[model samples]
Target: MDIITSHPRIVKMKKNDITLYISTFPLETEDDFLEKLKETFDVEEACDGKNMAECFAIIYGGIVISKNSIFKRIELEGYFKESDKGIEFEINRFLENPYNCYTFDNGTICFIKNKEKDSRFVDNVGLRFIIK
Candidate 1:
């Protein structure tokens, strides 16, 4: 995040852009999940622990977590998945669902979609915010 000024939260974005997709593989407890999201992710989900953890979210995407330090952890604790390509494929598939909206911080806040398996730029470029 490139900082232009402090007050309004304006920052330069990236070129290729990166989207971090997060998820809990077989959650321990719904109660814990809700509290964790509320505390850590600042996200909330209705509870009851009635279904598998997958039901809580789809693709569980987020941002800025694989910055070398994070990827260093092992399976017992590390967040980054072992297979990135696999995860990318899965994310591409996940984005295909109509309910999902794929976006990027590529120099501008852009709402995008998967045009093909590996399409980078969208035709319309969708909605964007250019920092003047």
Candidate 2:
């Protein structure tokens, strides 16, 4: 799925017709977001991954308004909502439970959620990556 289109915004999920880019904090990709984030990783390595980071960034209003976005920091691995767009159904961050997404300010998206909190990070993205 070489999504060379303007934005990967599908507007509806094939499975449930779930509306896209209607998140609380704006998940829509902006026009220049690709260029802004292009600096963070190797072009091929960065854009090419299961995390679908680039796809999500592109479709979900690609503009990274803040340098503090989770994408700028870690290698988040997960399955994409739309295999073509690269949005690996991670989390809205606002609607999802803190246990499913990364809750630490130090900058880290947790892949594993442990109940034992040693005054460290918190898992808000849940136990699994939502593979479907």
Candidate 3:
């Protein structure tokens, strides 16, 4: 696994959805990360692996939210050939707009939220992204 300490916001929500705060630095080399993500998510390769090259930042977060009870489980058999990373699936219920979707090179889907310093949603969500 890559050194993900900087982006502590990446976490398991429930069991299917992943929500990521994209303002942080991007994850490891976009290519490698996407390859791992595609294998992790089990999404069929839509085109040649070349399509993955256009991804932006690497996102890490939970996919499952409270509204849905079903969990999106990701099989890690071929993705990580070594150590077994504890993977958790979660459902995402906070999506109010499709514009919030952020996709990495490998097809990892992350929901992003952009807010001001004094936004009430931030205060209520109690979300902290700092590594400390």
lDDT of each: 0.27, 0.28, 0.26
Q: Let me know the TM-score candidate 2 reaches against the reference structure.
A: 0.17
What ranges in model 3 sit over 4 Å off? 1-9, 15-24, 30-43, 46-132
Models 1 onward score TM values of: 0.18, 0.17, 0.18
lDDT of 1 by residue, 3-49 (tens): 12111111222224323323333322324544444344433343335
lDDT of 2 by residue, 13-132 (tens): 111221222111222234443433444434344355423433443434321212222442122222212111222333355234323332222233322234343222211121111112
> How large an RMSD does model 1 have?
17.2
Tens-digit lDDT track of model 3 for 1-132: 332222112222222233322222122333443454445543334223521211111132222222233223221111111112222222232233322323322333333254433221211111122322
Clashes of each: 1, 20, 22
The clash tally of candidate 2 reads 20
Q: In candidate 3, how many clashes are counted? A: 22
Q: What's model 2's lDDT at 62?
A: 21
